[model samples]
Target chain A: MIGTWTLFQRESRRFLRVKMQTIVAPALTAILYLIVFRYAMGDRQVPGLDVDYFSFLIPGLMMMAMLQNAFANTSSSMIVGKIMNVHVFLLMSPISAAEAVFAFLAAAVLRALVVGSVLLLVLLPFSDLSLAHIWMILFYGVCGSLIMGSLGLIGGMWSKTFDDMAMVNNFIIMPLTFLSGVFYSVSQLPPFWQAINAWNPFFYLIDGFRHGFIATGDSDPLQAMGAVAILTILAVLSAWYLWRIGWKLKE
Target chain B: MNALEINNLYKVYGNGNVALQDVSLLVPEGSFFALLGPNGAGKSTLINILADTVNASSGSVSLLGHDLFHERAWCKRRMGVVPQEIAFDPFFSPREVLKFSRGMYGQKADDAWVDELLERLELTQHAHKITRQLSGGMRRRLLVAQALVHRPKLVILDEPTAGVDVELRKRLWDFMRELNAAGTTILLTTHYLEEAEELCDQVAIIDQGKLITSRPMKELIREVASSSLCLRYAEPLQLSDEDKSILSAFSPRVYDNQLCLTLNKQDSRSDFDTVYQAAKQRFGTPVDVSIRQEDLEDVFLRLTGDSS
Candidate 1:
């Protein structure tokens, strides 16, 4: 357990060391999403709601930052390990697969939290978003981060090249996050797109996170929790399986 | 009990490349065993198997009498591995690296020992610098220092001095010899046959994933030390074609200023003097003759020839 925590601590130190890349960059990207959504639809109001566009987009932006950074943390770390061949240092020790998985997942969650915190801080002055349920906000934020981070671990383990990793990020993760109601609500979409959004896991994460900022949309908090929980469980299991198989790790 | 034992180890890659085949060797307690092989000769694979970084398809590896696959943590605690690759996170200082390695091995942090390792490896000056900031040679020494942080009973170094300079290489061999003297069994895999010849008590040569030979250094070298004598004369020697042909039967060669001969068991000291006297009398100038013993490279070439 101490070994696991030490690994986590080492990763956290690395996170702090590269704050410009890990923290500032994601927060900057989130701020860009805010500016674009605010400018394009500032005066526009939803069909049955009075919320401003910036206010509505804040939670989604936070969730996006949380998810992307979480994924980036694990994937980038592992890819760097591969490129530098520094992974032998970790493997030559007595650290187990379980410990490695937890440490990486924990680091991913921490990176997500840092970026999410920065996003929330930067948006507080510009938007009228309120904190309705802080617990829901915290739970979904961490859960979403874990899910993405674990997926990143799986991607990193599966990737033999940087291009392979970019494919997962650009094609799979980007498309899912974009179509999961980041810029718009699923209710406004047609039936086909609505069903696709319903199946998208990011939809629940953003919907749950939005519940914390506003009094809500997209789904019930109970359903949101269940969705994110299932996705997190599945992602964790896959990451653990990859580690067990020593996918690209032992070879 | 042997400090390390490998029995019929085997590894076959998915593509059917046999990285190791029935490879077996033992490092007795407090022995400095050298595993010598050329590139792609399964040396790294053997080291990886013992380090538990790579799995074997068959046979077994035991460290300190504990099964490597079953008692991984227990065996790992007693073993240290300095892998061939110079690997270190650029984010960490040498001190942090040592601390982390020690902690990972389930050993309590001992600043004194860590300091000693740093001092011994001459990494104290750069102990606080991130790995990326250090010079290449310093990084190599840190690899050695990192492996020693846990005070493991067995230290396995896989080409630790491959890129290092002569001074650092000698320093490592001296440090390793001291460690062996202190009861830590050392296993080294290297391409430097001369280094192995000088440093290792027991040597094993592997070829094409198989253990070609394993024997004590002195015994192996002595068994293969076919002596050679080279004669250098002050004046050119003229001989008939038939006489030159007769000299060629002794495996003799004339080049530059010398005549070389393959010293055989049948050639006695009197025979050497007679040949020298005859060459001097024929050339009308005294001939200088010398004999030298064969080294490990000769033995390695003879045993594992240039097949692959």
Candidate 2:
């Protein structure tokens, strides 16, 4: 447990030491997203929902920040350590693979929470959001971050270079998050696209998180939570399996 | 008890490249041992396997009486490794690095011990500076300090002085000697034969992924029973066909204006005396004469078959 905490502290310090890039830059980007989408389509309302577009956008943006920051935290740390050969320090230590994996996940989730909280605070004045079901909010926030953090660990272990990590982020993570109803609801999309969104785990994450804020969702909150839980488990298991096999880690 | 023991260790990579081949070794407790080998002879591979960085295809390794694979956590806690490459997070300072390294071993941070290590490695001045800002030698020293953070019972240093300066190398060896004297087992691999000859009590030579010889340093040196006699003439000696025939049997050749004759252990003083007489009879007189005894370099070359 001490070993895990120490590694957690080290991973946290690594990102916090470069706040301008890790925290400040992402916070600014989230704020910018909020600003651009609000000005472009603030007064509009969804067909059945009564809330303003800006209010609806708030939860999506917050979830987006949480997801992306979580992924970036773990993926960037792993890739940088791999490239620099610094992972050897951890590998040669007495820390078990499970401890190392959990430490990284904990650090990533911590960063995601910080980024999400900051974004929420920054956009609070621009829109009205009800935190009626705080339990759901906390659940989705943590579950969403855990899922993304696990994916980040998988991508980090599979990638051999920074370029490969960028490929995973740009092609896989970015596209999925963008199309997961961040700026608009899935109901506004065509039936075929909505069908596709149903298959994307990110859709459940954003939908569940928004349901936490507004008590409104396109799908059953229970079903969304179930899907997110399953996906998180799969991602975590994949990362653990990779670590156990020493894939691309031990030679 | 042996500090380390390996039984029939073998490492075959996925590409079918055999890195280690049935190699076995033992280092008694409190012994400073040297593992010497030419490039591609599996020295680093053996160290990596012991460090748990690389999994051996087939082998059993015991460190300090604990099975390396079965009781890896225990073995790892009792061993420290300084790999051949410089590996550290550039974002971390030396102080933070050591603290984190100690923490990884489930050890509490001891500021006094960390500071002492920094001072001993001459890295105190750079303790707070980011590792990337440190000089190459300073970075190397920091690596040494990082490996010692947990104060393991057995330390494996793989070419630790490869790029370090002379003064730093001296200090590093001095610290290593002190640690060995204090009962810490030290296993080192170095290209510098003189360094090995000076510091290591026992030496093992490996060639082509096989152990060629393992013995005490003095014994290994003495086992190579070949010497050379070097003669320098006042001027270039013009030799007749008869003198050439006599010197040819001894493989005498002019090197840097000196005639060098290779002599085996069986060759007596009279054999050298005969060569001296022939040289004097042919060249009028010799200006200088010296006998060179076989050293570690000779033994290493002969064992590795790198000698011409």
Candidate 3:
């Protein structure tokens, strides 16, 4: 635990010192999405959401920041280490796989929170958002970040070249998060699209996040929470298993 | 007890290339052991296995009586490694880099010791400079200082001096010797035979993923006593028919204004006397002869074949 905390602190220090890359960059992305989406659909209101389009977009924007920052934290960290050959520093240490996973995930989640909080604060002045259920917001936000962070770690570990990592981000992660009904409710979609969204784990993340904005959701909160719990467990398990095997790292 | 031992290690990559093949060796306690090999000879694989950065396909390794796999955590804490490549977080200063590395090893912060390492490696002046901006030699020194941050009992350096200039290489060697004298067993791999010959008491050679030979440096040197003799002639001495007939006996070659000979492995005393006598008779005056005793390079070439 001490070892994990030490690594976590080091990672935090690295990100903090380079705030433009870790904080300002992600916040800028959130602001861009806000300007574009708010202009395109500002006055429109969804049937069951009980808010303007910007309010709905705020949750999605927060979730986007959470996901992207989580992915960037681990992927950038590992890939940079691999490229610089400084990975030897970590590889030669006494830190175990468990400690490594803990450290990386912790740092990723922290970045997610920082970025998410900034988006929320910046958008708060422009909208009338109720603090309907802060607990649920925190829960799903943290869980969504963990899932993406763990996925980033798996991507970083399995990639031998930078191109492999870039491929994972562009081809898999981006498409899923964008098409997961972040802007509109899945209930309005046709049967085929709804079926696809049902299988998407990101759909559940946004659905759970939107739940915190209102008292109820189009889907059951319990179901989305269950999905997140299961995904988080799988991410932790896969990371732990990879570490034990020393998968790409050892050989 | 051996400070490090490997028995029948094997590593077959997923792509079906064999990286290590039935390799095994022992590093006795408190001795500087050099694992010498060619470019693709599995030196990195062997080192990675001990460091737990690479898993072996089969067999076992132990460090200070601790199993490398089963007791990996404890074994890891007892060893340090300086990898051949200079890997660093470019954004960090030398001090931050060392502090982070020390923390990763599960050690308490020792500012004085870390500062001393930076000082010894001649990096104290650049402690606050970001790593990416440092020159190649400074980067190499930073690698060495990072490896020693945790104060492990055994330190392994894999080609730590590959591209370093002569002055820095000598400083690295001196620091390594000091560590060895202080009872930190040093294990290294190098292409520089002179470095291995001068520093390592025990030497192991690997080729094509297999262990070629392991012996004391002195014994290996002594085993290859086909002394190299270079003769500078006053005028180019033409090889007479008689000299040509016996030339194969000495493995002679002529270049520019000199003749070089590698006497047969088991050259008879009479053979050397004959070559000297023939040279004098053919040239009508004795040539200036310089005899150099066999060294590790000779043994290395003999066992691995000469490329240089």
Candidate 4:
């Protein structure tokens, strides 16, 4: 247990040591996003909802930022370890593989939540944000980060270089988050696009989390909650299996 | 019981490189042992397997009476390895690295021990500085300290003084000797034959994924000494191509102006008389001749057949 805690503490401090790049940069990016969106849609109202555009947009942005940072934390930590060959220290320690997996996922989840809180506190004054279903908000906020963090662990284990990690972030994660109805309502899109969004796991994360703030979105909150929970289980399990098998970790 | 024991160890990497082939070794408890090998001779592979960073293809290792793989956690608690690569988290200070390593191995925080390690390693001034800010030698010393933080019973130093200055090397050895004197078993791997000869009581040399020899240093030197022969001429010797070619068949070498060769068999007096006749023709009367005791470098070259 001490080994696990030390691993977790070390990983957490690794990112926290670079607060300017890990925490502040993401929050700053979120504020810039808010400013641009607020000016671009001055008088727009979300479709079939009484809330203004920024109200509907803020929750999605916050969740997206949280998820992105969560993935980045684990992936970057792993790639740096591999490139520097410092991972041998962890491998040689008395900690078990299961403990290592848990430590990394826990640290990645913490980074996600920290980034989300900073984004929320920074953008609170600019947007009309209120918590309608606080329980749902907390649920999706944590589960979403876990899911992303698990994926990040997998990506980090598989990536051999920085460019490989970038490919995952740019080609896979960027498309999923953007198409998950972060900026606009999925109901306004054509039926074909709505079906595509339904298949995206990020849609469940974003739509379920947005439902917590406004209690309104293009999808039902209950179903999204169930879907996100299932995906969370799958993600965490995959990460654990990869770790146990030592895929790309042990030779 | 031996501090470490290996039986029929082998490692075929994912790329199908046979790094270790049926290699076996045993290191006695509380003894300073040296593992020597030529480049790409599987020294690092063997160490990595014991360190738990690389899995063996077919082998079993026992460390301090615990199975290295099946009971890895138990063994790891009592072992520390200073790897060949210089690796550290740039954001972390040396102090943090040491404390964190001890904690990772399930040891409680011991500030006194940590401070002592820092001071002994001459890293106290840079203890709080980021890893990149320190010099390469400092990082190497920090690696040594990091491995010793948990005070493992068996410590492996893999080329720990590769790039270190001579003064720092002396200091590192002094600290290591102190630990060894206090009952720590150190297994060191180095390319410097003199370093091994000067320090280690036991030595093992491997090459081409095979173990050539593993024995007590004094015993091996004595065995090589009996097989060594040197013929000295009356003057600074010069040999023609024909004469040198005939002497070459005797595995000849010139060391300290003396023609040196090893007597391979138990009965090589006939071979000795042949050398006397050949060298006597080329360089006049033999002034002095005696049995030449070979050093560690000669033994290594004779076994591995690697001149360079």
Best by DockQ: 4
B157-273 per-residue lDDT for model 3 (tens digits)? 988997889998998899999999999999999988898999999999998899999878788777765686668887765555676567656655555566656654444353566
Q: A39, model 3: CA deviation in Å?
A: 3.9
TM-score of each: 0.89, 0.92, 0.89, 0.92
What is the C-alpha local distance difference test score of each model?
0.82, 0.86, 0.82, 0.87
- Among all candidates shown, the one with the greatest lDDT: 4
Candidate 2 Cα misplacement greater than 4 A, ranges: B229-262, B267-290
Ranking by lDDT: 4, 2, 1, 3
Sorted into a CAPRI-style docking class, model 3 comes out as medium
Model 4 TM-score on a 0 to 1 scale: 0.92
Off by over 4 Å in 4: B226-260, B263-273, B278-292
Expressed as tens digits, the lDDT of each residue in A186-232 for candidate 3 is: 87889998887888998888778877986555678776787799899
Give RMSD (Å) of candidate 2 vs. truth.
4.2
lDDT for each residue of candidate 4 in B186-299, tens digit (9 for 90 to 100): 999998889888888899999989999999999888877545567876555455577668767656666546776666553533466666676677666767888765788888
Q: What is candidate 2's lDDT per residue for B1-308, written digit by digit as tens?
A: 99999899999988999989999999989999999999999999999998888999997989878899999889998898998998879889999999999999999989999999999999998899999999888888888888899999999999999889898899999999999999999999999999999999998988888998888888877666467677887666554577668777555556555766666544344367766776667666668899877578766765685633
Q: What's the lDDT for candidate 4?
A: 0.87
**Once superposed on the true structure, which residue ranges of model 1 sit more than 4 Å away at CA?**
A48-50, B229-291
Native-referenced Cα lDDT, model 3: 0.82
Which residue runs does candidate 3 get wrong by more than 4 Å?
Answer: B223-226, B229-270, B273-290
Candidate 1 yields a Cα-based lDDT of 0.82
When superposed on Cα atoms, how far off is each prediction in RMSD?
5.0, 4.2, 4.0, 3.6
DockQ of 4: 0.79
